[model samples]
Structure formats: C-alpha cells, structure tokens
Target: MNKFLFKVSFIILFLFLGTAKTFAQKLKFLIPDAGIVQHAGSIGYFSVGAGYEIFKNKKGYLDFNYGYVPAFKGGELHAVTVKLAYKPFEIKLSDWAKLYPFNPGFFLSYTFQEDLAYKFHSSEYPRGYYYWSPALRPHLSFSNEIELSIPESWDGLGINKIGLYTEFNTNDFYIVNYLQNTSSLSLSDIFQLGIGVRLKF
Candidate 1:
C-alpha cells in the first residue's frame, strides 16, 4: 500500500510538473505487471509507465510510454526477465468483442538492457564478460499479447478492466552459444497465464 501510494503521488506530481501546458486530456498512469513462468521457480515483476492517449475526432487513439524493468544480471537465467511493451489495444473492449479473433491486444517494446546469461556457481563460468554482443543479443523483444476479458468487466473504455490473457506469443530471444553458462536458447517463448490492469480514457 505504501509503495502504491508513493508511486501514484510521484506520477501525479510529475504529470503536472512535467507537461501541464501540453494538451487537454485526463492524465492516465499505469502499473503493469506479470509473472514469469520458469523451470526453476516463478518471480513477479512490476513496471511503472505513464503516457497520454491522443483521442481523435470519431476515430482511434494514440499512446506512448517510457519505463524500465530491473533485475539481476543473471535474473534472466533463473526464469525471470523484464519486457517493455507499448500496447495499443482497442479503446473500447466491448466494441471489439463483436469483431473476429475475440479478445486481443498487441504491443511493441525495446529493452534498455536485458540479462542474457547467468554466471552460475560464482566461478563456474567466466565473469569477465556478462552480456552477449548486440548482434547475438537476445535482450530485445516484440511480443503481442491477447486476452479474453469476461463480460461486464469493461464499461467500453477499458477502465477498471479485469481479464485473463490466456494466449501469449513471444518467440524472440538472444542467447549466445559460445558464451559460458549460457545456452543456445532461453525459456522465454510460448504461451502462459497473465493478468493485467488497463486505465484508459
């Protein structure tokens, strides 16, 4: 509770102090999070991102975000990794339901810096180089998420939304084969269970 309040306060303070004279729209802040499915164990991560939804005249909306997710340099090896997503789902969930593909969402993101391999057993693997070359770097990701929201959960604005992201598809990863303690592949792709909140206008 304390942490949530502090973040909310910071968001409000920055929203006004940073860009008060920019536009005429309700300021929306989001705290998005999800659990990582791992072979060893699962860990939770949270990201704080705030952006404006540019409402068009009788049309769609445009949104932007800037945030970061932190973790151990080897956290990616222990079944945990963070992704920055720029999600642009339909503003009206109910309206989209009437269309094909049922409930859906898609996002584009770039990682500031991601852990590619783990330095297991302290000295079991060399620690001189911790990250793979950007060419072989598997830190960046572009994953599209789609979820089925239970009826009556959304008032059409996507606010106070609750649903299950029963489908997840992220098939991109960068692990170096020649790198020590790092394999040719890491457990990042495939579908998993997900739950998130959408505070939209």
Candidate 2:
C-alpha cells in the first residue's frame, strides 16, 4: 500500500483574447486530507497527488485531479478526486506570500470524488475518521472553488506561490454514521494546506 497517488492532467482551451492567440496549461501533484476531519487533535497524515490546469486569457479553463492515500502512514484511506473548472471572468491577487490570500480564480466548478476509507481496529492506532459535511446527502457531492493568485510576479521561479497553496472549500466526508449525526449545514469548511511547487507563465 505504498502507493499514495496516480494521476495524469492537461489543460485544453478555446480563446480569442483579441490581442493574440495564447494558451495556458499546468499540471500539479496534490495530497488530499480526505481523512483529516476524523482526527481529534491535529495529529494526522498528509495528502499528496497531481493536478492539471488550463487557462485561456482567464476566460476559458479546465482542471482535473486524482490522488491516493500514502501507504506508509495512510494505508486504510484510499481516495481519488476529479474536478472540472470553467472561468468566465478575470480576478487578481497576491503572488508571493507565506500565507495565501482568501481568493482564487474560476467562477464556478464541479467536483466528483471517490474515497475508500480505511478502518483500524488496533488500540495502538489512532481513531480513524472522515471529513463529511451537510451530513445529509447520499455521500456524493458537488462543490465550488474560489481562485486566489499571487500578489506580485517575480522573475519566473514561482517563489510566490510555493510552500502552501490554500483553497477554502467544502468538507465532504463519509462514515458509517458519523456525519449523519452531525450538523445540517448545506456546506462545511475545507482548509487544504499542502506542500508543493507552483509555476507561472
């Protein structure tokens, strides 16, 4: 179970920016903490995987991602995520900051995820848990994402958008009866902070 993630990504586009024909595409490896909300303390495993992004003058764009739980520390939680993004407007933000801003690109988004949660019975193991919200659905969900970019651009090393890229999303978790016994909000808070590198064009 040493496998953490397996994914391939690409950015395709159609555009008439009026200045010239330009295309943008990006691929990234991401780690999703699908099993984070189950933890009592902050002691938990990290998420890792890859992703792809394509932006055409910030007008038309598409993104997709997939990930797996690490076997070294995360052998029971097997998760995969796929997302689609389409932007119809232009937004801007900071580029180089340790703490990322509270904004992102893309006006609307659709996401579908499949996670195989791992259950441990050993007392030596921490109580395994999941991150589920709205606690009212059939375990499947659709979410929305807001984009926040760099505050300023440097030479070209992506020094501004590195270390931790934050995205405030919905916490969609699933358990045998855990979330079903929680709150009844339409959406939950999802704070994704992972380690990775970012590149800009």
The models' CA-based lDDT, in order, is 0.35, 0.31
Once fitted onto the true fold, the runs of candidate 2 whose alpha carbons sit more than 4 angstroms away are 1-55, 59-62, 72-78, 85-100, 104-164, 173-195
Query: For candidate 1, lDDT tens digit of each residue in 80-162?
Result: 23333343333334643311223333334333334432232346557555443221222322233233443464566544322
Error of 1 at 81 (Å): 13
Clashing pairs in 1: 138-174
In TM-score terms, candidate 1 sits at 0.30
Best by lDDT: 1
TM-score of each: 0.30, 0.32
- Highest TM-score, which number? 2
182, model 2: CA deviation in Å?
A: 5.8
